[model samples]
Target: MPDNMALIEERLKLYMINLWSRSYYMGTLGNMSKEVVERYIANQRTTKSNADHLSKENSALRH
Candidate 1:
């Protein structure tokens, strides 16, 4: 499970750095099992949501 998480993070980072090659990212994700892919997507959305919430909280605190 740890290894799988690491692999997902690595692939995600690689894809983020190479946004121009979206096909590669989609292909790599397609090779993963459906469960793993779903988890990865969920993690990404959760992370972004958390970041956005934190940013809003910080802005509110500053004002």
Candidate 2:
């Protein structure tokens, strides 16, 4: 089984690939600016933090 970090990285890469492909098809390939990349990074960080919090809460409840 893959570790948590590895799994996250893999999923992130897949998501980026899908996003880029869609953008390319929509003719927004050149419009991908730094702000967009930063937003994506921030979104990923928020998602990971939320997932971690949920996992901790679930474990605590279980115990």
Which candidate has the top score in TM-score?
A: 1
Give the alpha carbon lDDT tens digit for every residue of 1-63 in model 2.
469889999999999887764232424446787788778768978999999999999999999
Model 2 earns a TM-score of: 0.51
Write the residue-wise lDDT of candidate 1 on 1-63 in tens digits: 999999999999999897775233668555678788878888988999999999999999999
Top candidate, metric lDDT? 1
List candidate 2 stretches off by more than 4 Å. Answer: 1-31
- Candidate 1 has its poorest 10 consecutive residues by lDDT at 21-30
Stretches of candidate 1 exceeding 4 Å from the true structure:
1-25
RMSD (CA, Å), each prediction? 13.3, 12.2
Model 1: pairs clashing at backbone N, Cα or C within 3 Å: none
